[model samples]
Target: MHNTRSSRGIQDLVDLFDCFIVDQFGVLHDGMRPYPGAVDALVMLKRAGKTILVLSNSGRRSAPNEQRLLRLGFQIGSWDYFLSSGEVAWKRLDRLLRERGGAEPLKCLLLARGGDRSAVEGLPLEIVDSGADADIVLLSGSMGDRFDMDHYRRLLEPAAARNVTCICTNPDKIMLTEVGPRFGAGRIAEVYAEMGAPVMRIGKPFPEIYQIAVEMLGHPPAIRTACVGDSIEHDIAGGRRAGLPTVLVGTGILDTLSRAEKAELFRRHGAAPDYFLPAFTW
Candidate 1:
């Protein structure tokens, strides 16, 4: 059994680490606004001279995510760096395209929140109207708030049948919505994979993003850095894999689970956090 200690907030463990890699959604905010005390918690960290990296599984690039946080009342000096899965994936895609000598622009079908095209905004790829015409499907965000599983099935079936590759930048299985948590873009990518389409997921529970985040933080020792988030599968698992300490916040995904259920969840995932916070507070 894992010895996961329960704590009231980040205040109990501030000095243990010099850097914090924090998850944006669920832990810090719920898409629409910052969670109670979240902004203050960040301020506390900043005041303590902690290097904060606001990491996210968001499919939109870093600039938009940073802007959203600012609009939501988070001060600019609270975090040191901000990185998103979409930004990493975009960089990789750009590198690959350059490596290919700019032969031809690949036709891409982008699925994002509210028809947002920021994922492909500055890329050389052509945005195709239909999956049938796409050379690749960019699963950036979920329209789960607007559409259902069947909607995605019909949209991706044609591309899956043709064996078009899917690049899923955000691998979050569920997303926080105004109503509650709903299926995320990763779930849509899973559906495409179930349809026999090739999917390359880039985000939490994956090592690449962590590596980039660490580098952005000037390569702090793993022991001196902690990963904070609400999802065990993504945040906790990814942190463990990246050789950093993990802190699970009860304010987000696991907020509704009973104590016994949470124990079972840790057992099922076979990875547990080192500490648990009631919320993202100072």
Candidate 2:
């Protein structure tokens, strides 16, 4: 029997867990600004001596993401730590570069937001334009705010033909930005994967990123930690798979769904969260 509860906000978990792995975009902010009561929730949790790791599927590394959070008026320094998929991707890529014994710098076809190349900073990855000149394809994000799946498949066809491995930093199919939902790196990665290109996807719904989050929680037992996020496919499913309890923030991508609709959504995904929060506030 697991401790599954329905609650209004994070206040319900004050004494249930020592650590909280919070999602960024929908739970904390909507990409433009922090959610109401979100900062206060962090403050309340900190005052209660709970450890908070602001986990995100951001394509940018922790540093830039930290800076962005700070700019968004979050008390980032008070956080126990902030971890992003890009940070994990960099570590794994570093190891791959070392173990592969490549004589020259690894030429990479980088498809990312313009001026958002922090993930490969100080690494051996050399960004190239054409996939034909690459050892691997690095997808941090989509080139534009919106993209077509067919366009991506066609663009990646050359690389797939060459058997180039694609490393996707953020495995989110869509992002709930202030302007509304838009295609994310995960959607593009799907196109590549569908085209017979080997893809390594990091972020939510993947176990490695969860493992990193657990390790960051000081190797605490999975039962003692709760993953709070919005997406059922990414957060709830991933947390359950990683053996940690999940609390779905109802205000993210599923904000429009009614209770019954949300239940159906969970059922369709084949997983249900241990808890439900209308918002992430305390």
* TM-score top scorer: 1
lDDT top scorer: 1
Worst 10 residues of 2 by lDDT: 143-152
For candidate 2, write residues 1-282 as lDDT tens digits. 134578877888887899999999889989889889998898889889989898999889988888988898988555789999999999888887888785789888888876687888888878888877888899998754656667677668889999899999989887875567888889888888888889999999899998888887888877889999998889889988999989988787888878788778788887788898889898
Off by over 4 Å in 2: 1-4
| C-alpha RMSD by candidate, in order | 1.1, 2.1
Can you tell me which runs of candidate 1 are displaced by over 4 Å?
none
lDDT of 1 at 175: 92
Provide the clashing-pair count of each candidate structure: 0, 0
lDDT of candidate 1 over 1-282, digit per residue (tens) = 259988888988888999999999989899899999999999998999899999999999999999999999999889989999999999999888878795889999899898777788878898987989999999999978778899999999999999999999999999989989889998999999999989999999899999999999999888999999999889998999999999999978787988888888788777799999999998
